[model samples]
Target: MDELAALTKLERVYRESSLLCFTETWLKQDIPDSVISLTGFTLVRADRSEVESGSSDHNLVNLLPVYTPVVKQQSPQGKEVMIWTEEASEQLRDCFNITDWDVLCSPHGEDVDSLIHCVTDYIHFCVENTVPSRTVWCFPNNKPWVTSELKALLNEKKRAFLSEDKEELRRVQRELKYNIRRCKASYKKKLEQGMEQNNIREVWRGLKHISGHGKSGDVLQVIGDQAWANELNLFFNRFDLARHRAPSSLPSRQAIHPQLSSFTPQLPAQHSALLPTVTVDQSTVDQSTSTPFRLTLDQVRRELKKTKARKATGPDNISSRLLRECADQLCEVVLFMFNLSLSLERVPALWKTSCVVPVPKISHPKELNHYRPIVLTSHLMKAMERIVLSYLRTQLVHL
Candidate 1:
């Protein structure tokens, strides 16, 4: 009814005009054309099928191309993510320091897996409770240097437009342009600084940001398509040995050396007597010399401190930044876990598992060969491995 009233007004305003056309009326087949019929024009209707069929000819006369303006669709904003700042780190450290780990993480009969899981869960809980976070609207074409001030200015511009303040809107537009230039200059300077410091990673990251190439482009979206994922899995594991084939048995020493098999002979009595026998008392030997090396608080602390804060977390969801920041509080528990693992001669199952991220080798990847797998393992496990490696190197030097 409102549409009909608008049409009547349009007819009155354009009394001398002959033709008026409307696209995308969204009118249903059941809606009669008489309801929306204009006063002086003949009612004509062209549905989607008619339009498509009429436009199918390639040699049609005066067929001017109609280019509709492309409107970018904004993606839905994601959930609020934690922001790790100095204050948040301090709060997390305090949380770790105040917690009684002995009471909170009482493992069931020295189960290393249970102990690790409990500790990780508690740490994650503390982080969630203590860390500061904010919702960030991530635009597809957003620049790396777009700060909060610029976002505020954009909002102000919108408000000015809504309020019909031309002067205010123009002022905001000028300010936004200036800030955008400043931000670009600042970002360029930072990239130059990174280059001067010989930080290849940061330089590459900045280059990618400038080129508008994001990490999202590298991800293969095979969610809910199990067949494609299975195909990729099979392609990745193409070189693996077939499970049905049993491994060939290794040849015996005698079989490897045919001459030795038939040439076995007993040593002469005189030569056997010449070989002097030397035996030492077992009680005289030092037993302490053969004891296994145990991990110390300092060793664990050193390894934790060495962890790079910017590195991605593993399957456990334990960030390297958390371990590095709270090394002092984490050292004792880690040391205990390390010693327990050594004593039992078994590592935690959680440490063995890793999250594999497939990174594309090309811009447009279509096959398995175009991707390389990057495995993210536990940071604590890496630290423990480093400790063992250092110990082995020290022992090797002494030998």
Candidate 2:
């Protein structure tokens, strides 16, 4: 008997070995009642650990509450049917001002008669069957029940099926939750990394200095290192320099700056004595008399002055503003590219502390880089100027 007792004790210990270690931590974090509410069946104390274990031992065990599924005798698996009860029918008929007799009549009589038959059949089947199932007949106007013959009709297998379905649904929900958490964590990490990168560059460059390589000989040279110098040299060697246009102004007739004189072409002077003095030929004179009136050049100039004084001042033009904005946009793009390149570490020497100058404060749009906000504004201004000038020219032609 002692030997038999010892063998049984060993077997019992082995069987219990698979059970959860009810450590203090696990005990304290017992499943909440709300979690229990999600299940259809109550969990026993012994099954708690089994239900709680997830895929791993370190992972929390999850238990999905079991429940009996409500077996609905749908017309066809794919087709959806609304089940209506007797009390519900009466309520709906009253609510909608429908005829009571019409509702109770044959399925073919009333518009909603088919709905009533479906409900009646489902309710009758629930009462007559011998299984563990709950039949809920939902009707319009919030009616939910019919006959009270559902005591002996529920079955275990059906309940198990419903429980399994619920478990599967819970599993899917858990997976989705985990995935969402993982994705959120990853996204946050990436965002923080980007912010860190930005901070590094911002601090290293300081506030005023340009972040990347500085410009030299119209070519961007890396701030430091042999590679950058070589690249800069190669780039500048191939880079073509562009000439800027001079601002428009009144032309000077007198001698001025040598550079201006060199660029300007000399105009031909009019020789007053080139034409020979001619006397009106008496033979060529016609005998017919004509009106001999013509206005003097001085009188014509006086008349033009009077017309100019009478003209109205129109709305101000934006040509000057347009040009300034274009310049600003170009500047902005250049600066942005510089800063961006600095972050990329392409030009080490330019981004260094010693060589770079403090960034000058830009008060106007003209200071912006060409590729940034200024470019868009500049293009718009240009288009507007073109349109206004074209319209003005057309109007002038008409005038």
Candidate 3:
């Protein structure tokens, strides 16, 4: 019985022999490895007898095994949605009305880009300050039919369930069911309205929402990392580099049109007489007839009014809704800027930049070609373009 007990004790020691620690072993260098070593175990030693700071070194070594809790990384947040109110819109218009336009008009030789930047920045500041915004958390598995009210009811139902209250649970469940039905009906109505208006984008969004198969979030997730983003950037810009590459050989003008190289034609008598032989002095020209076509306040206002309220903003972060809402107050400044731009024959640099959004063409996109680039440009620039187009159209009709 004693031998059996000893064998069991040895077996237990061997089973738990992963690590063995010892301290305060008052031995000398003469104590060889054979004396301290055990079978099937390797030994390690730290000799501090010759060191001056033996105690401090021992303390430092003891502190090395301190615990550090693991920190969990958080998921990226969703985009912030601004809540535009009637009062806020009114305030924004009022703010615009109060702003002085003389600063923009005062500088005669000021850069067009600077003037445009100032105007857009001021408008953005006013809108941001006046409008209220909130962040809506979007989860991967979130359903479009789940409204805030429904979520609150769900929480109540969960509490009731935990508390074992049958009546409360039943009441909450009924409310939840009703809300779900109402939300679904409203959502369906919105989808119908989108279809009636022929809004293809909204229609596709609705279909994706119902089917729970949106590729936007998935694409963003895949490209969120820097490695994938760099690869996509290189891939997308490859064509640009190729297009701008210098050619090896150039074609001569004569080679381009071999027949024109030796042919020299003379004008007919009627056309030759029509050509002006004398240069007209600038001072003698009619000032009224030579004046450039200028933009009118009414034209700017009309274009501003035509701006779609819910359209996405450009790189400047200025919304179309603000422009449409404050058309009356903004038309004068826009008129002045447009005329100045016409006189100088220059467009604002800010207007030339656009925000590019990559939209996926397939459900699971692997290649960069599977994405379509959608550009969002400045609404103000577009308004100016429309005014210019109208003027050109009228001029064309007369010709």
Instruction: Show how many residue pairs clash in every candidate, following the order shown.
Output: 0, 26, 0
- Of 1 and 3, which scores higher on lDDT? 1
lDDT of 3 by residue, 100-187 (tens): 8887567745578888888887777887898989988765555777788888898999899867799999999998899899999998
Candidate 1 C-alpha lDDT tens digits along 1-399: 444344345544333334444544355445566655566455455443345324321211111123322223436456777798889888888888888878855644588888888878888899889998888777665778989898899999989976779999999999999999998899889999999999999999988887866656455543437786677767666666466467889997578897775676567798998997876544433433468769999999999999999898899889898899899988988888899888888999998888876777877687778878788999999999999998777655433
- In terms of lDDT, model 1 sits at 0.74
Against the hidden reference, what TM-scores do the models get? 0.67, 0.14, 0.62
Among the numbered candidates, top TM-score falls to: 1
Query: Which runs of model 2 end up more than 4 angstroms from their true locations?
Result: 1-265, 269-371, 375-393, 396-399
Candidate whose lDDT is highest? 1
- Model 2 lDDT tens row, 200-281: 6544433222322332223322244777445544443342322334556865744456577667656545655675676654
Q: 51 in model 2: Cα distance from truth in Å?
A: 31
Question: What C-alpha RMSD separates each model from the true structure?
Answer: 10.3, 33.6, 14.0
Q: What is residue 122's positional error in candidate 2, in angstroms?
A: 62
